[model samples]
Target chain A: MPFTGKVLVCEEKVHLRRLLSLIVKSLGQHVLFEAADGEETLLLYQSVKPDLVLLDVNMRQRDGIQTIQALKQIDPDCLVVILTSLVNHLTAEECLRLGAADCLRKDLPREEIAVQLARIIDACFGDIPA
Target chain B: MNVSDQPSPMDLKGRKILVVDDDRLNTRIIRGILRPQGYEVADADSGEAALAAYPQFLPDLVLLDVVLPGLNGFETCRRFKSLYGDACAPIIFITARSESEDVVEGLAAGGVDYLPKPFRAKEALARIRTHLQNRLLLEQLSKANAAKNRLLGMAAHDLRNPLASIRGLTEFLRDGTVGPLSTDQLDLVNNIHDASQSMLELVNELLDVSVIEAGELKINRAPVSLTALIEKAVYLNNINATQKHTRIVLQTCDLPQPYLVDAQKIKQVLDNLLSNAVKFSPSGSTITVRMEAGANGCSVSVRDQGPGIPKDEQHKLFKDFGRTSVRPTGGEKSTGLGLAICRKIMEAHRGTISAANHPDGGCEFQITLPS
Candidate 1:
């Protein structure tokens, strides 16, 4: 069965946001939303209440960590997967400890990223929960 | 470069030479030989005097006599060694003790060479000149090497962000995420994309090397499954395999025990080898990944069906910027620093990585981690 859910991608770069939107669409009949920074992401999270969030770590104003904290405060059940090029493992782990769904490497080849996202979608929306 | 024949006297002008001799006659004679050659000479009547004069004179070289009035030459030499540490200026012992035993003792005491007593002026001058020249050259080379590393680190770091942006934008163009194009336009965009990706990989690898060399390579070891790591590496590498129309086969023996490793770094090493196999092999070939368990340790090997590395160039494969005669089958580019980084990461894990020609054909790269 094709996985379906709402995904909100928060990235500072417009191109990355657009690309991630495209990948999320290619996955299934999932509704998609995009945010440029943490503040915008939280405002959208309040209104949209998307089933999934694709967060970037390094951002202006508030970062992924802060945004995730705010999102959890709103709804602890919120599913978020980090999509970043962050080389620092410690930061990634900190996000995980704050209840992140998973962390994906942005530096990977496009197909590999798509495959990983697909796997996450299966686990998140299918029989298995991530 | 004969010690006696080469350095012009002017080259070492004003180089300080401390004469640590109790005899005033011997000090004067040595000064007469060195001063005419443009050397600045300072004399100490005894070992204690020489140690006291050291800080003020800051001599480039020291000439000590073994048969001193109080402190022995060997003892003084040892003291000098302790003061300067590794880059201590050359210490030549001017002593009557010319026995093989004395020469060994002098060297063992950190003396550079022995200028036996009753020495000819020419021999003393030659020895002094050679050592001084060597010291100056070593200092210069070390300075240059450090400067080069600093430059490399900065340049690589500066180039990375912009290069990543270019790669991302070009990838968007190639994927038609931005817009579609004609065949020729698509080819141009694809070429640009590939080039940017190659440069991005090179820059990233250089950054990894510099960061590790800065002594910041912290290996966070955990009980990781090597078999699972290899499986993921294959899954990721298969994207390249699909692009090249090659098949990747994975074989494994059950490794139930948890093997300690930094999962991310080991994955990097495996990825490099698997991608290399993809890069060098023919389009319609097969790549094999195997994980084995041994009594001493566990091992992972990646074998490619490409032209085996030539015996002569095999030695160059793992060295920094090392390249071989074979070219990538698909015109794929290598960072050249990939294997070098892989070797470094393995070394951190107390593991070893090696490459060899497989008996069937092509080359195989294997890494072993001690259990």
Candidate 2:
């Protein structure tokens, strides 16, 4: 299997961030970055420039919508996937309109999340790394 | 006016009542009839005075007489409705005439009820008590409904995050990502993962039910192949069937290729039927899924080689939290919400689901969708 690119897991909860990091690391040989809030996510996006950002929709400051907007400004091609506990179609549609790759429910199985992230990564980066 | 008995303290306590009558003697009689029952009474000799006192009095009910010095009862009731809308208190018109036209006109003008004059204290009190009780019940129901929605929202938001974390961490540990684990530890981790998965399923079902009840579930309809959908549902449930040593076989006869439907919702219906079949069938039993196209539409049925549903319990099959005498053969967890959700989905798709006892002796669940 070829090396997948870097991923940034942005969530307010420490345990969730750790779990996501572990899942991404287990996916393949991939670099991982962590951010506890949208502010941290924006700051880290500049230095890390990860291929994908898993952003939590209900963060303390600068929630998922704001973070996605700022990330798009920084890099038009940046792939941001929303992580939310509530499965709301309206919120997902709004996130997609704001340039999010997808909005995923947090309650989904880890394997399913991994599969979705892999698909998004493949679509964004293709087989050959950029 | 002879007051036979004092009104029940329970019936009239804490109620504010406004009595509008041009006759001061009538107002005095009403106060004598109500004040002893722990009621707060306000007297207005004319419709004009009633209107002036209503805002300040904030009464729970009003007794308005039609023959007032100014602004008669019907017109006063209409103005009261305009002022307070549905929030206006219940008004019982006190009139001298019992003519149907007068009653109809009073009702049309926003009076909830009418009392014929030469007022019998007992009848008047009885009507007042009934209306107040009904209004109280309606208020309580509305409040309870609002609270239920709030609780549902909070549960959908707060419960899933922890459940996701637990499932993820358990899977992480089970996969031996951090280090090797003993067989015992691995089994424990697997159990935790399964429990979390079941909880997640329950939460999702509850969320779906709430959304459907709120009429917020949106279905994106398209032409979807019924063959492909059944194959996918069977594939998804293969592991579940295998665990219970059950085999699922799909049989189709003159089935339509594709139907205009919401693919995701139909898939959910299929998944629910397949899961129920697998959950109830004995080990080594065969479950056959048959699809047939008819003049009206197409139907898919899953027949399980287990106990047939009780004839008496058939009507309860599609209701929320409906359970039957048959138990899950594989000790699988069921929230008793799967069939309810399936029924709701089918209703949304303009389809139908039914259950019956097959002649060969088992329960068969069927779903029919328009072609």
Candidate 3:
């Protein structure tokens, strides 16, 4: 069994989006919306109201932190996971404080998806079956 | 006391001179020697007076006597050193301190050269010329170091982002979240992932060292939230933390305020601190991370329950290639670059990082960055 909730995937890079969408589909989770950058992330959030968001930290127009802050401000319950390759402790802490659901390094194995998704879903939206 | 009376070794046609000595005779003698060279001269008989006149006079050189009535010559020289660092005009000690020991002391106290008792005015002029030339060379070296540091920082930054992107892609593919991955395939991915991460760390350290060399490296300054940074750092490093069965204690201040800092750089500093804490601590011991505000800045401290840093070796901890003889608990290969990078990053933000054995019998790494 996999996650059934609607998930909005936002990443600046194109290959990442395709890969992320594939992962969500494989996990039995719905890819309710997709965004290439921060601007699109925000716009999609309005129309899709995704139960989850996978956000790339560095993006054009608005950065990951600003986008997360804005989305949280709008919904107050937005589940946003910061996806960054350069995992500086200071930035990870900042994203969490700014109301990000979690901060995930982009380098984990595909097999570890369920474990990570479970942890984030539990951390942000409370312990519930995804 | 005319412009042509003194020896002309001093090319003071455009230079300024400050005469600092409590003795009326010494002031008069300095004036007699320098005035004739067309040098602008200002006299301050007291340390207090010298400080008051220094900025106003903007002298090209200072003739300080070692035995002043108050705030003696050594103290005056030290204050002046602080005022201008290595960039200011040379302070030549034209004093009556004739002992070899006294001469050494004067030079150590910031005097570029010591003209002992019964000094010829002509010789003093020659010594001043040499000091001025040396000072100019020292200033140029400092400028060069600053420029070098900036270039190093730029190189580090440029190399890091692409490495991160590559690491991210590797991570995305390895996780098997996009599809399914076999156990053997996953193991291979893990190895690749770890190697890339290690390379990433090395690249960061290289950048940090470059910044330190140039002395122009500083932490990015902005309003930062500590709680978020801490959680993220701890989480990222949790695997290592778990291997040691170490627990992390995070204590936020009563009124946690937003600190001004470049968040990414500070996080690197914090990660290094935490990594060191976990590395050195005994298994099952607790590592406490606390954030508090002080008179000058906000401080984050990582206290580890491990063998403390020996006092003798503490001074060299931040030096390039300076590593403690004590090895990591699990025989973890230390790049020996962590603390050096930590110090450089902290300094870039006008902050400081220091380590000490905690009173409770462990090691503590404390970082203070201005708010």
Per-residue CA lDDT of model 2 for A1-130, tens digit only, reads: 3547878999899878888888779778888899999999999999989988999887769878888899999999998988866555566677889989877666567888778766766666666746
Better of 1 and 3 by lDDT: 1
Q: After superposition, how far is residue A128 of candidate 3 from its true place, in Å?
A: 6.4
The regions of model 3 sitting more than 4 angstroms off are: A1-3, A13-33, A56-58, A64-77, A81-118, A128-130, B1-18, B23-43, B51-61, B78-90, B96-105, B108-110, B116-122, B171-198, B207-371
Which tens-of-lDDT digit does each residue in B266-336 have in candidate 3? 88888888888888878888988888887777788889888998889988788876888888887765777
Model 1: runs farther than 4 Å from truth? A1-130, B1-97, B101-112, B118-122, B174-187, B238-256, B282-296, B358-361
Order by TM-score, highest first = 2, 1, 3
Ranking of candidates on DockQ, top first: 2, 1, 3
B-chain TM-score, candidate 3: 0.63
Worst 10 residues of 3 chain A by lDDT: A105-114
The ten-residue window of minimal lDDT in model 2 chain A covers A84-93
Best by DockQ: 2
What's the TM-score of every candidate structure?
0.61, 0.72, 0.54
**What TM-score against the true chain A does chain A of each candidate get?**
0.93, 0.87, 0.83
Model 3's lDDT to the true fold? Answer: 0.76
- Candidate 1 total steric clashes: 0
Per-residue alpha-carbon lDDT of model 2 for B1-371, expressed as tens digits? 13654233344488899999989888898888888878899988888899999999999899988777779888999999999998899999988755667788889999999988777889888898888876776666667766775677568667777888898998889878899999999999999988888888787777777677667677898888888889889988978899888889988676666688888988888998998999889999999999888899988999998988989888878887788777888778888778988998898888899999999888899898876
- The TM-score that candidate 2 achieves is 0.72
Report residue A98 deviation for candidate 2 (angstroms).
3.5
How well is each residue in A1-130 modelled by candidate 1, as lDDT tens digits? 4666678999887766776777677667888899999999999999999999999887877988899999999999999998766354577788999999999876666677789998887788777545
Tell me the interface RMSD of model 2, in angstroms: 1.7
